[model samples]
Each structure stands twice: as C-alpha cells, then as structure tokens.
Target: MDLSIKGTNFLGYLPSQKGTQTFSTFSCRYQKSNEEVFHQITESELEIALEKASAASEKYALAPIEKRRNFLREIIALLEEHRTLLVQQFSKESSLSEDRGNVELARTQAQIQTYLDFISRKDWNLLHSQELNGVSFEKRLCPIGPVVVFGASNFPFAYSTVGGDVASALAAGNPVIYKANPFHAGLSEMVAGIVLQAAENNDLPDGVFSLVQGNDYWIGETLLKDERVKAVGFTGSVRGGEALLNYAKERKTPIPVFCEMGSLNPVFIFKDAFEGRTKEMVEKLSSAIKNDGGQFCTKPGLLFIEERGSEMFINAMRDEFTSAAAVPLLHPSIYNSFLKLSSVFDRFPVYRVEATAPEYSVYPQLTEMTAKEFSAFPAAKEEVFGPFSIIVKCADESEMKACFETIGGHLAASVWTDQSLSEEWMYLLSSRVGRIIKNGVSTGVAVIDSMHHGGNFPSTSDSRFTAVGKDAIYRFLQPVTLQNFKS
Candidate 1:
C-alpha cells in the first residue's frame, strides 16, 4: 500500500484538482498548519461526482450480495495492512495518542466486519413471503440509491471517511459520496484511497464510491440539494445536522437524513450507590469525563445526585479533575468552541483543574448547581464539547426526576443505584433517552446487534434508525413488495 497523502479529491476513481480554492489541515500536536495544501471540490467537480454516483447506483445495487461482501472484506484487509501507517497519520493529524488511534482504527475494522457478518446470514435480505386469497407476495429490502455521507470530526477513523456510514451505505448497495471533514483531510484522503482500491480490486462500478474534499459549507449544501441523492448520513453538531435536514426538506423530493447529533448524556447517582462505592464510582466517572479529552458525543455532560451525600462525591470529583493532565483537542476550532461553551459555567459555582500543558490543550472542569438553578438556566442543558460536566445536586428523588424531565432527548442516561429503580423512573428515563445504562459510564458505546446509538429529537434526526452497528445499514435501504412476481 502506498502511504502517501495526495491532497486531491477522489471523483470516483479519478483524482481531480480542478478547484482553485484550497485549504490545509492543522497539526494539533505541532500546534501549526500542515505543509500539504488540499484542493476543495468545486461545484462542477461535485456535479461530475454526483453524476457518476447516480449513473452507477443501479449497477452497484443490482450487483450480487457476495460481490458487495467481498468488497467490504477487501476493505477490512486493506485497513489492517495499513494499520501502522494509518495510526501514525491519525495521531499526527488529530493530536490524539497512538493508542487511541489504533483503538479507533480497530473499531472501524470491526464495524465493517459486523456488516460483513450481517450480509452473510441466510436472511440478510430480510425477505418475507405471504399468501392471501391465492395471491403470492414477497417483501424484501432494496437500496435507496446514492447517499451523501458527511464525516464527523471527533472519531476520525470510526465516523469519518471509510467509517460506519460509508461501510453501511456500501453494504446496503448504495453508492456513497463521502464529504471529508476538513479537520483531518489528509487522513480522510488516505482512507478514501484504500476504499477506492478495494472497490477497484472487486471490479466495482466507477462511481460506487467518491470522496469530496472541502471546508466550505456550500459543498455539503450542494450535495444535499441534488435530486439524485436518495438519502444522507451525518454525524456532527446539532446545528450542522439541522442545516442538512433543512436542505433536504427544501428539495423538490425530500430524502431521509439520518443524522447522529450531539447529546448531553446524563448520569443519575442514588444515595446508596454513592455511599457504597464512592471511590470506585468516582474513578469511573472521572475516567469517562477525561477519556479522549471528553470529545465523544456520548460523554456524560451532566450528573444528578441527591444532596445528602453529594458533598463528598463533589469533592472527590474535584480532586480527580485537579490531578488530571490536559490534552490537545482535535482542532483549534474545536478547542475554541470548547472554551466558549465551557465559559457559561462561570456564572455558577465552578471548580476547574488546569495543568502546565502545551498549546491547544484544555484541562478538565466541573461545575456545580442545584436542580432548581439548572432548570432555570437554559444554557445549563447545552453540551459543552470537551472535558467539562455539570453536577446537579437534587434535594430529593422527585427533584432529580424533574431535572431529567427538563433535559431534551439524549443518546443515553445512566442510573447508579444499588436497588432497582421504580417503574415510573425507568419509564421516564427510557422515554427520554435511546439507551439506559445501569451502574456504568456512558462513554464507551458497544457496537452490536441490539445497540441503539441514536436517540429522539436533537440527538438524531431520525429515531427510527441508528448510525452504528449492523442495523445502521437499514437506514440506506427501503422495503419493496413483489406481487405474484417470478424471476
């Protein structure tokens, strides 16, 4: 595998550099701009890619499932083959540790393997046959045509180019036009190159996959406005997702937009749980908050605890935050956003921990507030996308429940209790969140058959579908019923 980064857009298999507008990715580790200059995809270049994808969608969709599976298999093999170089580039571009990079890369490969396993099953097509009044009918899943995937900035390998969205879209037989996140454009380009290689090796259609590189908002807007695009897959801030959703709605023929947006995943701690395992819970929560500098969307941004034993837990958390070392975020823009959002906590009682760290690095912070104060302050609910969390001290169980009610939809909410929670409590928590964690942290998301990484409203555009795991492929597929049809 050639591990060179060519700062060009992959318009199908061809590398084109027609656009004069250019940008460069920053090195968070070096605290400076990278040397390579990347070309942005112009409207004309984007139109060509869209046309190719539109032209090849049917061919790719109609291709044998085994062929698609083989393409995915090749991608997995290529990813593993280039793991060392890819991890190096990932760490260099994102300023994340090499271990984190390797872990994310492995997760990316595992995600593809999960899809491969799904497609290999006998009932992979989800075929349902029925007979009524001597009439035969069969229902099966079909591709939704070319899909536009907007890469996420946080998880460069797991959610960016050649990530779950791209893998699931390809598995569902939909041609993908991947819009590379400019934060890690070089890494995205390398991953795109690997996917294109796999497609070529499998004798796939020319437009089965395309990569568009650009930092401008119009690039994504133009992709969403195209009538040929059947659906969209996005993972980013709520604002970014909403913008794409609006663009899709404004189109003459609206398409489904599966967006995995930000969430304020809250953790509720009962008196018994805190008292029984105070030290253990403190370590777990601190680790969750400080993991990857708390850049994950599922990072616990809020913690609800009863006021009786809240002081000890708060002090323990403060101690943990104070001792922790700071780390650089993925980009300057992300660091800037984190600083701006976290400043909102200054109005309330805030305990911050800072270390002697390099540029673009941020320390962990903890903010304290009462349930009533939290409800009164609308900004308290907003997600501060860094190692920052708000601790809400509730007077009683009812107050804690009320705090949960004030929160909008989230990806997950955790309950730390030694005893079983009431039916009412469970029902309310389940209704408000997509996933409920018991006696655990909300940072690590499991990619499995039953995993639900999506949530209601602002957490995701469509709660019906997920953006992770094997079920994610269903987002790019629609059902078709055949009546008395023969092969």
Candidate 2:
C-alpha cells in the first residue's frame, strides 16, 4: 500500500528493514534494560512534545469557540478529501467487511462533525452560576494539559489517532500525544501525519499532536507516569488497563487514568419480547454475536432469560449460532488464547451447548443454567471475549432481580421486551447498566453526542465517563472554578 502523505513526511515514513515491513519504534524498556529501540524518537522527543503542548494549551484554551469549531470543520473536510483511500486502508488492516468498515469510517467523521456542531452553539466554557454576598461564583470546564491517549487495538481509525479521544481532548483545548495500536502501526502513523498537517494548516502549535508507534507496553507505562501528561484515555482489556493504572498510581504526581476495561455487557431477554418475535430476536442476536468478530467492548457476553421461555430462545439462538461462521480474532495470540479458553469451558461443569463453525473459526454455543444454578456458579459471569455468551435462566421476577444484582457491573445492559413489559423492565435495567437499551442487540454502538459508552467498575476504571461519544471528552477534562471576574 502507498504511504498516506506525500513528500518529506517524517511521521508517514516507517522504518523498513531489508524489504520487510516490521512495525517497530523507540520503546521504553521497563524490564532490567535501558535502551532506546528506535533511536529517532526517544524520551527527549516525548519530553519536548510535552513541554510544547503544555505551553500551547494555555493559549489554545483561550481561543474563541468559533475558531476551534472552524479548525475541526477543516479537519473533517480534509478527512473527506481522503475518505475512500482511508476507509480502504482501514478495512485492509483491520480485516473488517466493507459495510462495517464504512460505517466506522462514517462514525469517525460524524464524531468530528458532531463536535463541530456541538461547539457551534454550546458554550463549553460559559460559567453562569450566581453567587451570594455581593460576589459572583461560577464554575466552568477547562482543558487539562497534554493528554496521552493509548488507542485500543480493535478500532484503528475511529479509536486510534484523532479518534473520539483526540476529538474530545481537542474540543476541551488539550493537546494530545497518541500511542497507536501496534496492529495498525503503519496506519496509525499515516493518520498521525494527517493530524499534524491539519494542525500546521490551522496554525496550531507544533507538538500539539504526536504519535508513538511501539510494540511494547512499557512506552505506555512511561508516558502515563510522566508528570507532564495530565490525563489518560484508554480502551482495552482489564489486565492491560489495570497495569497502566497501577503505574500511574505509583507516579510521584499521579494523573487520572481513565481506562475503559472489559465488560461482559449483558442482554436481558424478557418473556414478552422473546415470545413476541422469537425468530427475529434470534437472527438479530446471531449477527451481533459475530459482528466485528465479537471484539467490541459492547459485545454481549451474557444473556439473561426467564426459565419459562428459556428453551424456545435457546433452540432458536442455537440454530442461528450453529449456522454462523467465525472470523479470526485481532491477533494470532488472541486466537490461540481463545481456543484455550474454549477448551477450558468445555471441561467445566457449566453446561456447554455444542455448535458448528467454519474451520479455524470459533463456533458459537449456548450454555444454559437454572436461576439458582446460574447465580450460584461464578464461572458463568466471566466474559469469554468472543462469539460466546452464557444463557442465565431466572425462575421468576424475584430471581431475575437477584441475578441482575449478583452480576458484576457492565459497560452496557440491554432489555428486550414488548410495550408493557418494556416499561416494567426499564426500572430494573436503569439500576443494572450504564447504557440501557430497548429491543435491540448491544453490539453496535453509535458514535453520537448523547451516547454514554462507558460504565462502572470493571467496565471502566471510572464510572463517570464514556469512551465512544461526546461524554468521552469528559475523560480528558476536569472542572476549573474561576472567581472575581472582571469584564
């Protein structure tokens, strides 16, 4: 594939080794070693980037809202200029289908446009609170200094360089340093060049946007622990996020680590909706289970059902899953690990439903357990992470409530119900999930201003923010109170 930017583009150029394309960059060695892997961009480069971004952030934050909106609008137009090529490159690297990749491409553009539209009217800095004692009190949102963003592997373009995290950070007037996913290191570098060009064209400061493409996790740890990095945004596994958070906590002046971890996002199937249209629900769910090969953070890992309708739903769901073919997970390591997990599940006492899938692809299966059996079994609560879901049966309303309470926190919880039942279940859902749904699969999350894509505890390190929508910006920002204003 041709490199993205033309002529003298430093960030766009990858270090080619003897005709082989190996994605490698300067990485911080954390384990008994002190060596810079790729000598060009070293710790000094990052320190300089941090200093420049921090200095520019003060001025960037004071820029008028209209100017900021214009900057993003220009970015959107430039992205549109290379839209087709960008989408194609993203698909080729990520192995996503044309339609799915196109949707994500559009979502990324929409996020930019949404932020543009959002800033056009919304005074993100207006502090209008009144005060007593002949003194005025007002609180407003301010940008935290340079933010370090660690992109998730599953989303290359939309969640990598200049993704939602970047969009929100920029909107809040914060500078960014993106650590791109290794799986798409080349693609990440290409997009990072575009962002830098956009920054230059807008007369934004140099070092406002930087990209570090490395294979190791230590670079991320070092960046997080850096005192200049005021905040962090991450989307990935629990193990990875927790490791980074621990590193941040160990820092002398620890910054906020907003890490979005794994979520066994559950889909609750009420009798009314299941009985209303069993086949449709089955088909809808089957596609969701396999969407993007079930790598989404919102992918439903657990399904709750009433005991009376469990059999019917299971049979239909099984029929759909058996026919569904699997795709390779993001990386070979993930695929190998998944196979091991599947084998372990097969040996467990938990009921395992047998199903068929394409050769080398993961097969979907349904494991059914009674209300008491499911609740008593902690194994059922674990997130299998790919095309796998557990069917937890509740004997009745009381059991269902207990099941929801017993279940761990999730990024999202879905409710499938008819009119009356939907109303009845809304209360239960509000308490159980961060993002609640009605009569739909929870796999496809729309990137919009109102969408709350993050959740409590294990779903994310913090419950107050989201990773996929306008709320995502909150992760990079903190409130600043200003007093005694003179106009």
Best model number under lDDT: 1
lDDT of prediction 1: 0.89
- In the range 1-487, model 2's lDDT, one tens digit per residue, is 3444321112222222221223432111111111212222445545565676667777777766666777787777777777677776565556566576677767888887766665676565664677667777678777888888888878877888878888888877888878777655655666766676676667776556777655566678778777888998888888888899898888899788888888888877777776677887777777777776777888888787866865777777766665665575555445566667656555433332345534335655555667777677777776667667777777666677787777667888877877555455666666556788778877778877777877777788877777776667666667766676732
Which clashing pairs does model 2 show?
none
State the lDDT of candidate 1 residue by residue for 176-260, as single tens digits. Answer: 9999999989999999999999999988999999999999999888999999999999999999999999988889998999998
Provide the clashing-pair count of each candidate structure: 0, 0
TM-score, model 2 to reference: 0.86
Span of ten consecutive residues with least summed lDDT in model 2: 27-36
TM-score, one value per model = 0.98, 0.86
Q: How many clashes does the backbone of model 1 have? A: 0
User: Local error of candidate 1 at 332, Å?
Assistant: 0.5
Global lDDT scores for all candidate models: 0.89, 0.69
